[model samples]
Target: MIKPYTNKAWYLVLPVFALVAFSAIIPLMTVVNYSIQDIFDANTRYFVGTEWYREILNDTRLHDSLVRQFIFSGSVLLIEIPLGILVALMMPARGPGSVVCLLVLALPLLVPLNVVGTIWQIFGRADIGLFGWALNSLGINYNYAANPMDAWFTVLLMDVWHWTSLVALLCYSGLRAIPDAYYQAARIDRASNWAVFRFIQLPKLKNVLLIGVLLRFMDSFMIYTEPFVLTGGGPGNSTTFLSQTLTKMAVGQFDIGPAGAFSIIYFLIILLVSWLFYTAMTHNDGK
Candidate 1:
C-alpha cells in the first residue's frame, strides 16, 4: 500500500496565526468600524455609511500629497538602485576592506530616524551650518527655509544619504553569494565588463534588487518622522507626504472618522502595490 501524505505539522503554526489575528486583524476591524461612522465625542458616534471614504477620494489635499509621495518614492528608487549597484560593484569581495566597507555602510542605518532628521536640520542651516555657509560662499542662493525647490532638494538629499546604504548592503550580500565558477566562466568567454554585468551580475542580483526596491518603496512611501522633524512639511508643504497628511488628519486635526477611512485606504494601497511589485519581480523566476 502507498503511504498517505500528512500535514499534521500545520498545528505548529496555530500560535503564530493567533498572534497575527490579535495584532493585525483586531486593529483592522476597529479601523473598519470607525471608517463608516461619525464621532461627535468620546460618548457619541453615528453611522455615516462610507461618507468618509467618498470625502477622502474627492479631497484635493489627498491628491496633492499622493503626487508628492510618489515623486519622492520614485526619485529614491531611481537614485538608490543604481547607486547601490555601483557601490556594491566597487566593494572588495575579500579582506579587511570588505569588513570596513560593511561597517561604514551600516553606520547610517544605525542612527535613529529622528536623530538623522535633527542632524540634517542643523547641518543645512544658513548661518552656522557648513553646507549653508559653503553654498552662500559660492553664491548659490540656497535657502531651504524660504525656497520650495531647496526644501525638496534637501529632503531628497537627506533621504538619499540615509537610505542608499540599505540598498548597497543588500546588493553586496547578493553579489557575495555568487559562486566563483560563474566568474571563471565569464572570464573564459572573454566577456566585456558591461557584458559580465549585464548577463551575469544583473541576473544574479535580480532577487536582491527586487527586495531592495520593495523595501525602499514601502519605507519611503510611509516616511514621516525624518521629514517632519527636518522641514515640518514646509517651506509651504513642499515635503508633505502621505504619512504626514494622515497624521495631520488623525492626530493634528483629530478627525477620527475620516482618519480611519484614510488609514484603511492607505493600508490597502500599500498592500496592493507591494503585491504587484512582488509579482512583477518574481514572474520570470520559473523560466
Candidate 2:
C-alpha cells in the first residue's frame, strides 16, 4: 500500500524560497513600479503609464544594440558549442591527464568577469600586450581600441576563451555518465568510431547539451562587464550590446523610467528566447 506523502521536506525549502522572493521578486516589483512613472527625484514623481515603454520600443539605439546583442550571442553559441564538444572528445576518459585538463579548462571560468576584461584589455593592447605585439611583429595591423572589426574580434575571442570550458565540462560529465556497456556493445558490433559517437555518445549528451546551451545563451546575452572593460563598447560602439545600452540609460543618463521599461522588455526577450530554445530542443523527445 502507498503511504501518504509528507510535506515536511517543503518546510526545509521554505527559507530558500522566501529568500529568493525577498531578493528577486521585491526588486522586480519595484522596477515594475518605476517603469510606469516619471521620476524627477525621490519626492517628485508622476505616473506616466507606459509612456517610457512606448519611447523605448521606438528608440533607434535599442534596435542597434538588440541587433548587436543577437549577433554576439549567436556567434558565441556557434563557436563555443562545437569547440567544447571537440575538446571534451579529446580529453582522456580516465586518467590524471583528465584531471589536469579539467583543472586547466576551469581556470578561465574561475577568473572574475572584470578581471577577464582587464586581462584581455592589456593583453590586446598594441603597445605592451603580447597578443598585440606578436600580431604587429608578424606584419599585421591590429588595434582593438581604434579598429571596429578588431574590437568585435577581441570581444568574441574573449567570450569564447572564457566560456567554452563550461560547455566542455558539461559535455564531459555527460560523456562520463554513459555506461561502458554501450561501448562494449558498439565494439561487439564492430561499429566505427564515428558511429559510436553519433549513435551512442551524442544521443546521451542531448540533455546536457540543452542545459549547456541554455546556460551559455542566457549568460552571454546578459554580458556587460567583460566587453565594457576590454573595449569600453568603443571604437564607435561597434561592440556595444543591449546591456551596455541599458546601463548607459539607467546609470549614465539617469533615465530611470525608460531604463526600467527597457529592462523589462529585455527580460522578456531573454525569457522568450530561452523558452523557444527549450521548446525546440524538447519537441522531439515526446515522439
Candidate 3:
C-alpha cells in the first residue's frame, strides 16, 4: 500500500516562506495600498480607486517609454542570443583554456551595475575616452553626447559588452554538459560541423538558451543604472526607458498613487513578456 505523503518536513521550510511573506508580500501589499490611494503627506491620503491606473494607462509618457523599452529589449535579445552561441561554440570545450576563457568572460559580470555605467559613460566620451577618441580619429564623427543615433548605438554597445558574457557563460555550461556520446554518434554519421551544431548541440542547448533569453530579456527590460549614468536619459530623451520614467515620476515628482500604479503596470508587462518568452521557447518540448 502506498502511504500518503507527509508534509511534516515542510515545517522546517516554514521560516523561508515566512521570510518571503515578510520581505516581498508585505512590501507588495504596501505598494498595492499606495496604488489605490492619493497621498498628500505622511498623515494624509485619499482613496482614488482605479483612477490612477486608468490615467497611467492613458499617459503618453508611458506609451513612448513602453515602445522604447520594447525596442531596447528586443535588440538585446536579438544580438546577445546569437552572439553568445557563437562565443560558446568558439570556447574551448575542455582543458586549462576553458578555465581561462571562463575567468575572462566572468570578469565583466563581477563589476557592479552602476560601475559598469560609469565606465561606459567615460569610455564613450569623445573628449578623453579611448573608444570615442579612436572613432573620431578614424574620421567617423562619433559623438554620443550630441547625436541621438550615436547615443543609442553607445547604449546598445555598452549593454552588449556588459551582459553578453552572461549568455555566453550559460551557453558554454550547456555545451559542456552535453555528453561525448552524442559527438561520437555525429562523427559516425560523418556530419559536417554545421550539421552537428544545427542538430545535436543546438537541440541540447534549448533549455539553456531559454533561461538565457528570459534572464536577458528581463534584465534588459528593467535596465536603469547603466543608461541613467551614461546618458541621464538625454540626447533628447531618446534613451529614456520605462524604469527611468517611473523613477522620475515616483522620486522626482513624488506622485505616490500614480507611481505605484505605474510600478504595478511595469511589473505586469515584464511578467507577461517573460511568460510569453518561456511559452514560445518551450512550445516544441512535447513534440
Candidate 4:
C-alpha cells in the first residue's frame, strides 16, 4: 500500500500567493470596480455596468491605435528575429573575441528605456543631431518632426538598435548549448555549412526563436516610453499606440471609467495574442 502523501512544502508558497493577491489581484479588482462605475467625485459614483467597455470597443481612436500597434510589433518581430540569428551565427564560437563581442552587443540593453528614447530623440533632431545633419547634408529632406513616414522609420530603427542585441544574445546562448557531437558528425560527413546549419542548428534553435519572438512581440506591443519620449505620439498620431492612447485617456483626460475599461481590454488582447503565439510556435513540437 502507498504511504499517505504529505504536501507540507506547499505551505511555503502561501507568502508568495498572498503577495500576488495583494499586489496584482487587489489592483485588478479595483480597476474592474472603476470600469463598472462612473465617478463624479469621491462621494458620487454611479454604476454604469458595461457602458465603458462598449464605448471603448466602438471608439475609432482605439481601432487606429490597435492597427498601428500591430504593424509596429509585427515589423519588429520580422526584422529582429532573422537579424538576430545572423548576428549569432557570425559571432565567434569561443575565445576573448567572443567575450568582447558579447560585452559590446550587451551595451545597448544596459541603457534605460527612457534614456534610449532620449538618445534617439536628440539623435534624430534636424537642427544639430548627427543623423539629421547627415541627411540634410546629403540633400535629403528628412525631418521626423514633420514627416509621418520619417517618424515611423526613426522609431522602428531605434527599436531595432535597442532590442536586437537581446535576441542575438539569446540565440547565441542557444547555439552554444548545442552539443559538439552534432557538429562533429556533420564535419565527418563533409556536410556543407548551409546543409549543417539548416539540418542541425536551425532545427535546434526552434525553441529559442519561439522565446525570442514571443518576448519581442510582447515588448513591442506594449512599447510606450521610447516612442513617447522620441515622438510624443506626434506627426498626426501616426505613432500613437494603444498604451499612449490609454495614458492620454486615463491620465491626460481623467476619464477613469473608460480608461479602466480600456486597460482591461488591452490586457485581454495581450493575453490572447500571447497565447496564440505560444500555441502556434509549439503546435508542431510534439510531432
**In model 1, where do residues sit more than 4 Å from their true spots?**
1-14
> What is the C-alpha RMSD, rounded to one decimal, of candidate 3?
2.6
Error of 2 at 116 (Å): 1.0
lDDT of each: 0.92, 0.94, 0.92, 0.94
After aligning candidate 4 to the native by TM-score, how far in Å is the CA of 174 from where it should be?
0.3
Report the C-alpha lDDT of model 1 over 206-246, residue by residue, as the tens digit: 99999999999999999998789978999888889999999
Which of 2 and 3 is the better model by TM-score? 3
Model 1: weakest 10-residue lDDT segment is 3-12
- Identify the runs in model 2 with alpha carbons over 4 angstroms from their true place: 1-17
User: What TM-score does each of the candidates earn?
Assistant: 0.94, 0.92, 0.94, 0.94
Q: Cα miss at 127, model 3 (Å)? A: 1.4
**What's the CA RMSD of model 1 in angstroms?**
2.7
Question: Over 4 Å off in model 4, which ranges?
Answer: 1-12
Write one digit per residue (lDDT tens) for candidate 4, span 12-115: 99999999999999999999999999999999989999999999999999999999999999999999999999999999999999999999999999999999
What ranking of all candidate models by lDDT puts the best one first?
2, 4, 3, 1
Residue lDDT tens for model 3, 119-209: 9888878899999989999999998888989988988998899999999999999999999999999999999999999999899999999
lDDT of 2 by residue, 70-167 (tens): 99999999999999999999999988999999999999999999998998999988899999989999999999999999999999999999999999
Q: In candidate 3, what residue range of length 10 has the lowest lDDT sum?
A: 227-236
Which pairs clash in the backbone of model 3?
none
